[model samples]
Target: MRKQTFFLLSLGFLSFTSCIQEEAPNAECDIVTCRVINLENYSIFYSRHDAVKEVASTDSVVTFPVRNGADVSAIALELDITPGATVTPASGSVQDFSQDGVLYKVVSEDRHWSRTYRVRFVPMMVLPTEYKFEYYELDPNSQKYYNWYGMNEEETRIDFWATGNSGFRLSRSSALPDEYPTVPVEDGVSGSAVKLETRSTGAFGNMVNMRIAAGNLFIGTFDTQNALKDAMKATCFGLPFSQKPLRFSGDYKFVPGKDFQDRSGTVISGRVDQPDLYAVFYRNTDDEGNDVMLHGDDVLTNPNIVALARLESPLTTTEWQHFDIEFDYRGTVDAGRLRNFGYNLAVVFTSSIEGASFCGAVGSTLWVDEVKVTCE
Candidate 1:
């Protein structure tokens, strides 16, 4: 009887030790605990122990370990709830945690998806930031419009003004004295002697007669020297009509002595019956000792003088008629000829005068307007 009792006690002790060895420390816990972490921004989330673990010993529970700085906003778990296990807080909420090592639950929501209980703690706010510049409108009356410059020992001030038409004007004061000319404007004419009033001078003023003659205004003359040299500089704008081979229409008449050459015996005439011929139309260098003359085989000789155009009028001598003359730069001329250097146009007259007449007598009289240069 003593031996059997000892045997039974030993057997019971062995069975108890075996049962203890078979059960895991985790399996012995009534509730499992876990923590969620955000790796991107170092945010943390705490889980509830009682809410995320199984109550029965047969139930399986998992606990996840998280660090202090981890992102738990999108935390997830792979485990499904065990048959005998119950999870708390059906769905997890991302929030700040007062402590670490929290428990979580893996609970099914529907037939397709399941959610895990989690808490997110973010220390810093995630937002977009940008840099920008401040802009201000320019003030016309501001003192910034003037610039001051210091020379040797003195200072000079320069004023700048932006005009209403988007143009700029500058003024400066000098220590030295200088002479300035008076400017005036009359009937569309503008010069140093005249202040320019009309921007559309081609419509009137010096070009007024040109417009009346041509039925259109040509950009007559600018202050540019080249424009002054080229009588038909305004033709650079464009042609007016559909007529082929652009033409200049005008009327011209000659008087023997008054309009023609005088006693200098240069074979050149003095003036024409129409003063407009010499005054308004042609660019004459005859008075300046340069007379236009024809040279060998398609070459003209002259200095400081360019014949714009010439045309024979079909109008009767009694009536003021119109004529058209076309001039072009591309034409064959003699080799090594100065006249051929810049031949933009040519003008021929029915009456020819000797080269000698240019020095003594005045040239023929011709009135010209309505000049047109067309592109071929």
Candidate 2:
């Protein structure tokens, strides 16, 4: 499952006593941790730990993955919130999560701030084979950017795709949704497809040495907290996958921007922008048994990578083009580890191949649709 779990850190006995002597509540409203209780009753989950999810600071939606037929209509949830904060619908209360989702509101201790979060239980019975880019809407929190979501074969909504648009929002907060780096296009090869473009990050970006933002989408999470300071780490890549991938195919239309630029936003003569599309399969643990995830810097060249599939040549075309690449295995697969969720898979697409280095040509665009992964 792509859903990340958490480890509840133990608080010191001294801290517990200090909480009882609190005189005032701080002005912070956040869900620090969340876990589903009574896991024994839910036989669908692999383990008690698998049902827990650590809420990200920038995330508004919390999701847990369970078997497709699992009943979550009356499950109990426990939430650890900020000091002196209060949560609506109450913690440790039974709620229905079989449909859309349950919305919970958290108010700061001083009532100066509030945040609404939607918690969901996602069914994970089958892997998604085809991506049609069908469902998308404006970012619910900001309403200033676009978000793309996919559906599984069972017609259940899936949130396996993540984008750098959230990071772009920091640079171009006043820009309209359509003007952002990534957006949804109504006139696609099929229904609605995703359009990625390399965009200029105004004066603030240049001041921070981040002159451009590239449009990118991948099968992983984006940590908005470290976006500006450490972009390579911000793009956490890959998701747990049990299947062995054979081929990756997709359709795309690309038009490169002229006069490619460097990290300092300086134009390079005779240079042209190039788009990137690739997938990686790798082990998800280090030698010491600690969880490991690839980032933008190591996704392509990581030593733990078992197989990779990448476009061999730069694709530059105005008309839609189809591409099918075969996975090239570099290491043997461990069947037992793969079955135990010990491996991860990453599929990535970017409007500018060098975008990770803050180098790319603004106005370069790439339209993609009908992507699929053929597995063994």
Candidate 3:
């Protein structure tokens, strides 16, 4: 989230109800938003594969996937500028995107401030068959490890890896992604692995009765629409997966907190927090042609899931241990559907088993490293 615009405005309420309103005279630095429309036509994932569009990563550099002979040479931009401010290269104009890093600028109404944005497009690459969490560069602006992509033997960045940390950082102490519960730990199986801890959501979250957000790492996008109200439904799971995974192997270390309690701070007598680890491969769409992505509530029971792998419980290890879970197929996979991206897969790890419902011990922690997904 490095290239995101900083929001400087907040409001209580306006007495009248009108969609259109007049702008303030001195609100010069009000050029609030900008977007590259028409990106879906050439982009591989406008959001989370087919689950979303337009609302996906508003990252400064957008990648457009053009085929060998397809005509994806131009793109259109849409801007929401200050009332009296001006944006160069006018909106709705089809500008050539054949070069790398196209620059767009916005000038404030009072001529006191200006903003510049760079637009970049990249051709798509094949999704890797395995994930070896090898490469990541720290996002300087947000201080979050945004890129946790796996690399193929050929040293190419795989397109299938994603995480749910972005949603988890919304209510953090400093909006710094590093302050999030899930982050990179130097002492990993390979080089750096992921550390997940169940954390207290602080005063603001307690006011809303959402006292906690468990530290989690998973293969999916965090849809903001559902996270605040119903966290179980908020973490939409799975990504386009074709591999018929047979087993999941990884190394992990876990520690339980001293006190276990529900969101209300009521202690659960004699209870020790445990980490939850699982993987699910399912169909991408339902029979009625609607997109299907499992949530915490339905993931284990969803009929769409063709196979599942869950680690055994009582995960209270202080030393790093190798763990392996076998996938048990529930039904046959349509071979033809595999060629297209009709299958979805999800891998999840949480510090607390009941973290989805905001129930957990704040200090519970889980460290994971060198995950190997064995598939057919």
Candidate 4:
């Protein structure tokens, strides 16, 4: 089976870390980063900084958001890949991206592993205001898990949504898409809704002291490799935003699993699972001019946060419920910075409030749909 890698290119800046060089050929085939050389010459981008992309370790697609009227034909990309690997349609080579998605292949130096990447370019960012959970599909390569995305008014697929499903794959390769923590269900307020369930990670998870995988969906990216070293940091949160958000509204149904457990999988006598839904707006850069992102640990408490809107209490009901929360401003927003994409917005949904700590009941479930973010 071929290894999989995912890449997301946006109008914001990101600096991807490179892997250390190994002495000998290894079985790793990955695309660490992607960029266009001296992108200033390309007037098609909203910003020259938009040309570079930070790659992640799961999924099989690469997407770039370009300004309207940008010519993708003969567009060239320079990829920074694993030391001993080689990519086809070679790096720094021009490829026609004017039509259907193009496929790029990468073979490891050891020739033991490979990955095929699907690349596509979409026109300008359409600030996502509503999410109905109507667009989703199975992972292209494995067909083992589902990937959810939002569609814009132009009918273009938006890649802003990210999930922990990829991280869950690390423990359950044989698990079916439905058996995975996050899935789509037919019984929705409308057509289809997302269902997040806390699931047992079985032996593999227990071995690593991570017994349960929480179902999560958020506006950001996931790094599987980083999760192994530091789970909290693995869930990079927020995306560049150009507006001041006012409120977050959504519909949902929830059921807390019977037995609450800790990271060691030991059930706590009286503890109960709780669902979490919140939206955060914050500065995307630090005082030192370095790009910044909140993780599972500090997303809510980060000093950079400008405003936050979260449910005050847990909601548990079999029937659908509605909630609308207003953003509580903690700081001021600079109009100049807002126009320059200096801030970010993150909206997160999880079946278990403490899922990031691997503490949740395996059967806790939350169904959600009709999400809307109101802005000024």
**lDDT of each residue in 120-202, candidate 2, tens digit only:** 88754344767788888788878888787777666776677889998888888888999988888987888888999999999
- Write the residue-wise lDDT of candidate 1 on 168-204 in tens digits: 1111111111110111112111111111111111222
lDDT, residue 50, candidate 2: 58
lDDT of 1: 0.26
RMSD of every candidate to native, in Å, equals 42.1, 11.5, 9.8, 12.0
Q: How far out, in Å, is residue 250 in model 3?
A: 1.1
Per model, state how many residue pairs clash. 36, 0, 0, 0
Q: Which candidate number maximizes TM-score?
A: 4
Q: What order do you get sorting by lDDT, best first?
A: 4, 2, 3, 1
TM per model?
Answer: 0.20, 0.82, 0.74, 0.84
- Scanning candidate 4 in windows of ten residues, the lowest lDDT window is 4-13
Candidate 2 is scored at a TM of 0.82
Candidate 4: which stretches are off by over 4 Å? 1-24, 40-49, 64-66, 69-76, 88-105, 110-124
Q: What is the lDDT of residue 121 in candidate 3?
A: 50
Report every candidate's CA lDDT.
0.26, 0.85, 0.70, 0.86
**Where in model 2 is the C-alpha error above 4 Å?**
1-25, 35-52, 67-78, 88-104
Candidate 3 lDDT over residue span 283-346, tens digit each: 8888876778899899889999899998987468888888888998999989777755678888
TM-score rank order: 4, 2, 3, 1
Candidate 3 worst ten-residue window by lDDT: 4-13
Q: What would the per-residue lDDT of candidate 4 be over residues 1-376, giving only the tens digit for each residue?
A: 1222223332122334444456677788888787876344867665555677777777567777676778788777888888889999899888888896578899999998999888777665665878888889997867888888887777877778888888889899889889999999998888999999999998888888889999999998888888767999999999888899999998999999999999877899899899999999999888886778999999999999999999878678999999999999999999988876788999999999999999999999999999989999
